[model samples]
Target: MSIQLRPTRPADIPFVYETEHAAENRPFLLPWTEERHRQALAHPDIRHLIVEETETGRAVGYVIIAGLTNPHGSIELMRITISAKGKGYGRQVLRQVKRWAFEEQQAHRLWLDVKEANQRALNLYLSEGFVIEGKLRECLKTGERYESLLILSMLSSEYRD
Candidate 1:
């Protein structure tokens, strides 16, 4: 069960887009267009990576990290999408992202906002040592309704490794 993250290539965009719009993943994330992904890929501040199963060389998921080019020590875990669930892929991806942020990137803080109703994601973030900083009420509008988001963060000092 070896997993690795690699730079996302242009050919991987469609798979990433499909995973982003998958029924199981859509509810937890904001709507996005293919152009947005392309922009991220081109942006100096963003890193778009594809998560692969090392044994099979299959892409299991993808992640988008932002604010890396900023002088500030804070970075955002902009997006992470796992095509398959219930197999610990999210946990593994998150652990790798944290290590990259705190260790490799020398970031002092890593943060993200999750929809409050996304219990599974909230649980994963909490279990990974991300602390809830606060809640933003009615922050997003999906269709005709508004939703709240919970802000979670992990500081470099709080990182285990």
Candidate 2:
């Protein structure tokens, strides 16, 4: 199925909320409140996008791009969540994001951090041309414990397109 990214609407918040807190996805991400999603939607610097299956118009995933409003030419891929995994959707979404960040946004650098144990996602990022810059140790609190994250990034000079 063909996938598309669209500007997230207010109505999409419920789905975003549910997806972020979904049992499978929760471990890899920090929990976000509905109000936080709302705030992101309202922020000029942030881009909250809904990833949809074009043919069925079903919302399958979401991605958040932050730090766009700055003049530093750097953008942080704050979050990416695919409700349905292992179907190659995440790869397609990452390709689209790279295109948008480099070709459209004209960004110099695009970066993201992934949980160290998320081998699937780490592999995906590596395959997508992101280089592991470093590791942030015990930087995020998941609940009762803190976890380390691997910082990965791609620069415009290194973008294939």
Which candidate number maximizes lDDT? 2
- For model 2, residues 1-161, the per-residue Cα lDDT tens digits are 87999999999999999999899998898878999999999899999999999899999999999988869999999999999887788999999999999999999999999999889999999998999999999998777988999999999999955
TM-score of each: 0.96, 0.96
Expressed as tens digits, the lDDT of each residue in 34-153 for candidate 1 is 888888888899999999998998999999999897788999998889997888888999999999999899999999989999999999999999999999999899999999999999
Where does model 2 exceed 4 Å of error? none
Give residue 74's error in model 2 in angstroms: 0.4
TM-score of 2: 0.96
For all the candidates, what are their Cα RMSDs to the real structure? 1.1, 1.1
